[model samples]
Target: MPRAVAPRVRRAPAAAPARPAPPARSRRRLAPRFFRWAVTLTVWGLVAGFVALIFFAWDLPRPEDALAATRRPAITMVAANGALLSTSGDLYGETVRLRDLPPHVPAAFVAIEDRRFRDHMGLDVIGMIRAAVANVTAGRVVQGGSTLTQQLAKNLFLTPERSLRRKVQEALLALWLEARFTKDELLTIYLNRVYLGAGTFGIDAAARLYFGVPARRLTPGQAAVLAGLPKAPSRYNPRVNPSAAVDRAIEVLGAMVETGVLPAAAAMAEAERIHFPPAPSRDAGWFADWVRDGIGDHAPPTSDLLLRTTLDARLQAAVELRLEAMLASQGRAAGVSQGAVVAIEAASGAVRAMAGGRDYRRSPFNRATQARRQPGSAFKPFVFLAAIEAGVRPDDGVADGPINLGGWTPGNGNWRSRGEITVEDAFAHSVNTAAVRLMQRAGGARKVGAVAQRLGLPGPFPRDASIALGTAEVTLLDLVTAYAPFANGGRRVAPFGIAEMRAEGRPIAWLPPGPTPVITADAAEAMRRMMAATVARGTGRAAAVSGLAVAGKTGTTQDNRDAWFIGIAGGLVMGIWLGNDDATPMEGVAGGGLPARLFRDILETHRGRGA
Candidate 1:
């Protein structure tokens, strides 16, 4: 043991080479350096935050400006008789008060949209975290964290553009809104300004639009349905996707139960009873669409407009019904898949009724105003009119035999033409060869086209002889308008729809100017007499209504691709067209058949009104 101790002492004395001393920097304490760096980072972060706030707040919308923002004007279209036809653009109902609403209505929205709506200042921090976690877990945007106040801010002051800058502005606006109003006030504004589906805005409008009821009368189930619309409105629209809408409403009811807004039993009962009213029949949509499209020409874009349109609600309904019924019953047999109907008041040129297609839900092509198809023999009237102006009378004899002009040979529909016939008789029978000869006698097809253009038909009309036989394509609207002078005693009628327009209960200085004279009364009378012969004893016999004087022409294109009847009856000028969208030939569908019959049916319903 003594030897071991001496050896240890000697080894200690011999001490290992001293280890190198730590650097001066390493010797200093880490706490102060860490504090300095932390302070530096903190100051930079504060500066960045200040710059971000300034940049985002630079263009912040003022509260008053946002409150008084201009939105697309809401158009309320009424028939000539003041019956509600349709609404377009942003449809806002009466400004509803929170105190007046059914408690369940606001509660339903709160439960589904924001559970802590009452507690949150504007942004829901806890909800944002929860939504973040849920979204990450589900790998999609499974939840939304926006409070109702925030939503209101977005709808009021911001575009739907998704960007950090927009979100910051939305947040700032939401804070402003919250600070300026109470919870009830915020909710009231939200309900009055939110967008629902089908071009509706505000809870009241949505209520009336979806359920045909006022906001105060909303049932719990209906309230749930409306509450569900704030998220993915089109996807959950009852009119567009009822099943998805019902499911979403049920989810809303369940949320109400979870949020203590409704008892579980009551919520379940409400879910079971959550059936939507059948979507309001849009029978007048064609007419409404036309009026809406043309409204801009009459009135400047405003916040709210009430249009007293030229549409006759009763006539419009009957026209749509008759057209759809005819297409349903006889369309397949005639190989016809689509049809259009348009009726214009003779004196004012107001479009009283319009059915653009057999089923508007299926196809909305406004064949009456938009589609240009060969009018066929329908163009003969203009030819005859030109001939009459060229010193030819209705009784003048014209050759109806086969004729060759400039390498084009035109023939009658029967393929056997009478050698010679009076101009009136030839017109009634829609003899193609006779029309070409009349065009030649009337200074060629150019003269006939000029006559048509003078009568409100837009044209750089074909200058060839085939134009006399309606080889030129023309819209049913223009053709019908051209025929209006025959009924209105030679006055040219510019087609009009809006009878009056009011902005926010104030009448706008808008009225369609009166028509001007385009043709002589004698010429108009002669043309009427010829067309009267058509309805009385010729191809348009099917269009004759009992006790009503009717004048019209029948048109059948080559291979029967298009069948048309444009007529004047009961002080109205009407046009009908039946054809396939693909321009395929129909099964022997002549204008004298279904088209004339449809005209007769429509005229029968509105017999003495227009007259």
Candidate 2:
């Protein structure tokens, strides 16, 4: 019994009753732990944000580098009449100051581009919110939130990319710019550096390019047009898309009314008065490109240049219109896809007008200067001229019948030869065999080549007898230049485009050397008479302009791959070439059919204007 009691007593003490924690104690314990967790989360969030900011700002461009950026040297081209023809490189007009601009000019841009420009510091939060709401409602992103300063920052120092990082950097750069520059100064830089369109890089250059006036002279309507360009430079370009530009300008005018910069009636008036000058003739672009390529030869390459060229704008327009009309009417039907034209002053050898193709946008290859093709019968003139130099008369008898020349027999265009004809008749009719005989009498192909070189045809002419039938390749420009001596009474003149090149208002001495005697005056007169006879009663009859002395040659290559008419009229030497770019045969097209008629039409259209 004692042993049992001792074992029972080993359960010694009874445990204390379990108790639940109070609500106040539980809350007090959780408060510190929750606070510590909150602190840790907040600190990590801040660190992440700082890392993101650094990631975006790491590659931000230096602000000072924006100011020191250099552009390619600008080339501004003007016609002989001082009218702007075209511009290449970075065409920035004279630096314009905001203070010098009309109040309405800046006001128009501010109203359309950034209504809150004066009220905010670059980052327009209200505008962003409003634009966001509007875009969300429209569902197609119909609104933009960028401030004018932000746009300037992106244009000056950033690539045009859309991403979160780019947006963040643009915002930072905008804020920095706003702090560093006054509002007016920022606007001045924007107006001076923002690209408008058509190779122009400023409001002033755009104004001159579009309206033929400076920025200071822009009307309200004109200013509205310029103000609309920043949205889409090429789309709203007044020169490229006038209707789109006008519609955009009308929107700008309406925005001006909304922003209280212009009254409703004034905006309506501006909409009604908005006018864009007719775009510059694309025909001039060919000549402009040629001058631009040769500009380095005349002026120092380091300076921006203004080239005053001898281009006759009126004649250029006429020639282009005629060529385009003719090609449009007949090119497709005849399988002709290309044409080129070159006109030069017969006395001074100045290129007055040039059209490399019917439509420059379709083909930019300068066919008149760059493409070298066989001149065909057009080369016969040089052969005949050589004969004249070697004591042959225009009336001298020559056999036009089929003849074999070193196993290569050449036949006339009609494939039927006139038995015995005067050398003038053989040349006028483009007789192939007679030209070969004349080449033989003129001491063969090499002798004729030397004569052509002296007369301005840059030639590494062939030595074969077939060279008499224009087997030699040459450019339309070279052929036209070689024909100039007859028009200018026998003086050799080198072809030139730039009359004067100026840098910083100082003229660079680039005058072409004076003309020299290349052929005897008597020989020149005889050739002129023979060429005139060819136009009057021979192969080039289609090239004649009524009551105007026109002399020219017709050239039709084998299979009609090329057709050409090189002529002189109104003291100008002009050349026309029609062909397919791949040298495919046309549909029975001959030089006498379309090319000669185009030459005649151009001459007639520009007859009385000193063309």
Instruction: Give lDDT: candidate 1, residue 283.
Output: 58
Give all candidate RMSDs, comma-separated. Answer: 7.1, 7.5
lDDT of 2 by residue, 459-526 (tens): 78999898898878899999999999888889999888999888857788997868899999999998
Q: What would the per-residue lDDT of candidate 1 be over residues 500-597, giving only the tens digit for each residue?
A: 88888889987676888998999999999999999999999999988878899999999999999999877889999999989999999999999999
Q: Give Cα distance to truth, residue 434, candidate 1, Å.
A: 4.2
TM-score of each: 0.76, 0.87
**Pairs of residues clashing in candidate 2:** none
Task: Report how far off residue 409 is in candidate 1 (Å).
Answer: 5.5
